[model samples]
Target: MTLTLHLDAAGWREHLQSVRNDVPGLVPVAKGNGYGFGLARLAAETSALGVDTLAVGTSLEVDQVRAGGWDGDIVVLTPWSRHDPVATALLGDPQVITTVSRVDDLTTILELNPQARLLAELLTSMKRHGLGRADLPALRSLAPVARFEGWTIHLPMRSPDPLAEARELATAAQAAVEAPVWLSHLPLDDYATLRSELNVEARLRMGTALWLGAPKTRRTTARVLDLHPVRRGERVGYWQRRASRDGWVVVVSGGTANGVALSAPTSAASLKQRAVALATGALDASGHALSPYTIAGRKRSFVEPPHMQSSLVFLPGAAGVAIGDEVPVELRLTTATVDQVVDE
Candidate 1:
């Protein structure tokens, strides 16, 4: 038994079609654990959607998508460099496109593969990577040898009115390099609005909102492998913390290695959201953390921190569960690794 992500295949297919139909020039982003469905699975789904281009996080993932039989163009979102020589060599493939954030990187890419398809990333408010608006003019020189596919921008969620900011960035990007702009974090309405507002074509590079768009169609769960009755003050789990009351200690099939007890930095901006985040942090520090796994439709407390491949959950005696039973788990798909993915 293991932590598994079960997908409602029929409903998921419908959602995929609905998204494809809604968003035009959609570049399905299948990157970073493939949004918990794995890269190969997303690649196959992209092919099924008749998409011409798929965006992956790193150059190394290009081959994985190709291996999935997606002959379409694969765009690597991360910038290329000498660090990954093998991936750099893979840039030579006509079907692969690399994102060039710096002028120097553009030079390196050209030197490595003169025919490399390139997407010039514009440095937005994110400030993570990308060339500045002023630097875009310099990229015009490489438009000849290196195939200038388009410009890419990553807008931060905290940006005030993302649509307005996106329009401004799109306008600036066009002045430097007049090409289609590949962007992320735009709602369907905003995407359409931006397209109408600007003369350039816009391609939405989406991951979470695409594959995991409809939460109802995706079900993640961990199987209950073993159970042990425990009394108050009885120690359990790796830390051997004493249970507060009489209950059963559950050995579930997911743990830290599977993304349990792991947390990514929150992007919460509102007052209530920030309050919740702070409270969650406090709860986590107390050694009485809330688990993703739920029993009797109520989230249970973890006996202690998750182990490498398993977690110890404390279920109340009243909420009974047998071995080999499955419990619902709400997890961040981006950070999770499911032992099995049942598509049915």
Candidate 2:
């Protein structure tokens, strides 16, 4: 079965504009499989949209925008390191911008190549990596070798009030050198609120909110492949989905290949607090369909466990639905890989 992802470009552009209204400056984040858009296409789109800048996950991503002839500034979000020769080269050129996370890393960058435009990464609670508030002055002290492009702060995801944390970080950013620019990965609502409160101009680094902002922006669909009626107590699939009652075993064309079964726990508490994990110590790579899909514009449920290449849906009364029928997978397409992009 072919995986199909549909994008309503007009819808997305409008969403981007709505998000832009919250923050005066926008830095669209085009990284990590390009949020399933592919980096180059996103770069082109963001460039055309007149964003202040575009941030990528790595130095390698710089080639993506440059190859497309995008003349806008490309910011590398990964923490600075000396080993990143290509990144260093791109920074040496004025075409790229970087985030300085550590005093030593920033020093190495300055020593390796002077005249690098840089944004001082103010450490946040996420604790992934960044220069702590205490270290900011020392790094900023190295003004002889580097020019402070702006200030940056990364907000934690799923926080109750990302705006509050952003405000706190914005307070710390005031200590940084001139030209403060904020980059937030938090929820758009939070970023928008804190952005308005910030004393300095803000650039919200948006990924999911821009590409997968809402269901209205995109749709994913998979076709039904096969179907069979099974009697009670009949076995089906590796899980031996025994029929609790008379129903048809419907085979759908979607599986691990489509990232159907691939999902990490929602949070630590969701996994740790539960006693019986969903598939812990399971006999095979099998599980119920986690992704919701619509059939005939009606919601459908997973009949049994999903197979390796396909999934079996328990279609009790929907036997009237047949093969070649198009079903929309109710999934966040940004998190799912798009096998094909069908417009309209």
Candidate 3:
């Protein structure tokens, strides 16, 4: 048995249809481990959704999407440069669209392939990528030679009011290129308002909200492979850390290799959330930590850091679990990869 992801097909289908209906021109984003469903799997789902376009993060992922028999148009979100030969080659594909954040990249793309289809990305408050408002004139100059698909606004995860921000950026994007605007992380309720206020054709590029918007539709679990009775103060795991109490040491499938026991900086907004993050950071400073594995309806502490392919979980002596029993696990989908994904 291995770490597995289970999908409630009927519920998932209902949610998918609901989103598809809500967002008339929804672009399903299938990148970054395909939100832990794999790239090819999401591509097939995108096709089933009957959308004409799909967005990916990198050029290498374009091939994987195509391999999934997705013949629809593909737009790579990451800006491309001469430094990326693979991405350039991928741009030669008729169906592949590129996003140009810098003026020079646009020049390079046009010089190499004047027929290239492109999107001019306007720098949002995110500041991660895209051309600034000042770069709009230069983008307009290069607009003639390049086949301009639209403009894009990559919004931040938590914006005070994304609709207001999008409304503000709409003017800059429209001035730069007289074309439609594509955005990410925009809420469904504000779609109509964004279009009416901005007076532009806005397309929503979604990944997490599309795949994981409804948490009740999916479940992830790891199987118990072995169990060992441990005594208090007995050293365990690779670090040889002593157990605080007598408990059953449980080995469960899923570890660092599968993106278990891995973490990212917290995006907490509230003061209480920040305090919890600080506490979590303090615990991480020490060798002791908690694992994602849930045993007996409670998350168990790790004996040590996870191994490459499995983790050691500590369950109290009174707790009971047989080998091969599947336990629930909460994982970050973007960072996670599983051996199997079962549609139940």
Query: Which is the leading candidate under lDDT?
Result: 3
Model 2 TM-score is 0.83
**Considering TM-score, where higher is better, how would the candidates rank from best to worst?**
3, 1, 2
Model 1 pairs in collision: none
Candidate 1 lDDT (Cα, 0 to 1): 0.86
Better structure of 1 and 3 per TM-score: 3
Instruction: Report the C-alpha lDDT of model 1 over 166-229, residue by residue, as the tens digit.
Output: 8888888787668888888877799898888777778998888888889998888899989999
- Residue 219 Cα positional deviation in candidate 1, in Å, after optimal superposition: 1.2
Worst 10 residues of 1 by lDDT: 136-145
Give lDDT: candidate 2, residue 129.
76
Write the residue-wise lDDT of candidate 3 on 1-344 in tens digits: 59899999889878987999889779999998999999998998899999999999998899899898798999999988789998898777889999888888888888888888898888888888988878888877888777989898889989899988888888877876778889888787876778766665778998999998889988999999999999999998888888888889999999899999787767898999999988877776775577899999888888888899999998987758889999998898889999899999
User: What's model 3's overall lDDT?
Assistant: 0.87
Candidate 2 lDDT tens digits, 206-304: 787777776677777778898898888888767576776787777777776666756665454565545345344241235433346666456555666
